[model samples]
Target: MSSDLWSFALNVYARPGVEDACLRLQTAGANVCLLLCGLWLEQRAVTCDEQRVSLLRTLTEPWDAEVVQPLRTLRMQWKTRAVDDAVLKGMREQIKSHELEAERALLSRLEGVAQAWARNAAGSTTWLEELAGAAASPNRDALQVLRVAATGT
Candidate 1:
């Protein structure tokens, strides 16, 4: 999608009423990697069919996409051996780097969508709740939004 369209979609998808859409996308096999893409489409109030949404859901699930696949690929790339301390340390650093890279990519995409919502001064409690639901773990910002939504402050 074009950058403008992508930005627009992110804002719409991050709105309060998009949980159902997110769930639908998750169920459809869309990767959590493409969360920004989904959020963008959602922000635009775009709707996907039941089949498509289901496919996206499958794609994003931990078992199918994010955690397991990366681990599997890593396992294949490295040899599991009883190495000395220095080698083990280097390997550990490499693994950490890989994990960090993956996290950065995922967060970058999600943030693209979330930044739009975060900039808004006014949004419904429902939008906050949806954002909390859609956010990955450690979603401090979404939690804050939820708190604001709850107190109506």
Candidate 2:
């Protein structure tokens, strides 16, 4: 897997069923940004522990909640207007671009956070599962789909 977080995220997300699975997990209150980061870390065989998970969450939660989510919400809200108005459509597309950039920035930050934890021989899905947390419990089927997609198992 690529060491670049953004590239890795794109690769993992493009896998069959991954997008839908991510959406499902997101609906269950999982942060898709963190999930993607966790997947990337897993690919790198990084040791996932409580401290690493906490650090990742600390780095991502505020940005995802304040920046990415708002951009995404606005872009989604414009869907109807975009279909009818060309100007609104253009603006919506711009918002989508911004959203993508925001996610890229988040991924970069996550990569930095995991820099020291990389290249370990030991890796597990435990981090991903822990990151998913209890909020994702009800969405186990969706989470499992994501796990399979991430690990190719």
Candidate 3:
């Protein structure tokens, strides 16, 4: 009944206060990428299957969660449907607010990552190249596309 690495890590890193928890966890040998991904999932309510989890296994070791129930609530809220105009309008506003918050959080994180890489990239040609790639990563591009589509202007 063991889960894959992502599930295990998500189980651990998505807990309340885990972002601040990472300083101690890093001292104990946790992967920063997993820490970041866990935070992202917490903020976005993204989930993965076992296969996807397995793919990330090698990049980081597994961890467990203490509080993921809130995520389930958010997921259920996301699944809810609006039946009438008032309900639909309220739902739409709520969804827009959620999306804006998520997008702002993601972009802020990505900007920090990109900036860190840019700042320390001196003389490390390979690292700089990799950093540049990360700056334009597919996930960021996809997010930009989503934002543009959502705004329609």
State each model's C-alpha RMSD to the native. Answer: 10.7, 1.8, 16.3
Top TM-score hit? 2
lDDT (10s digit) by residue, model 1, range 33-147: 3554344434334443444344444443553366546753564455454144567557756776776466445545444433443323342323322332445344434334323
TM-score of 2: 0.91
Q: Specify the poorest-scoring 10-residue window by lDDT in model 3.
A: 123-132
Off by over 4 Å in 1: 1-64, 67-84, 124-153
Q: Kindly report which residue stretches of model 3 are placed more than 4 angstroms away from their true locations once superposed.
A: 1-80, 119-153
Query: lDDT score, residue 89, model 1?
Result: 54
lDDT of 3 by residue, 4-68 (tens): 32333344444444444444443444334443443333223333334433444332232112122
- Per-residue CA lDDT of model 2 for 6-107, tens digit only, reads 877787788898898888888888888888887777777777789988988999889998999999999999999899999999999999999999999998
Question: Which candidate ranks first by lDDT, i.e. highest?
Answer: 2
Root-mean-square deviation of candidate 3: 16.3
- The positional error of residue 12 in candidate 1, measured at the CA in angstroms, is 25
lDDT of each: 0.44, 0.82, 0.36
Q: Residue 91 lDDT in model 1? A: 75
A best-first ranking of the candidates according to their TM-score comes to 2, 1, 3
lDDT score of residue 48 within candidate 3: 33
What's the distance in Å from true for residue 98, model 1?
1.2
**Ranking under lDDT, best-scoring first?**
2, 1, 3
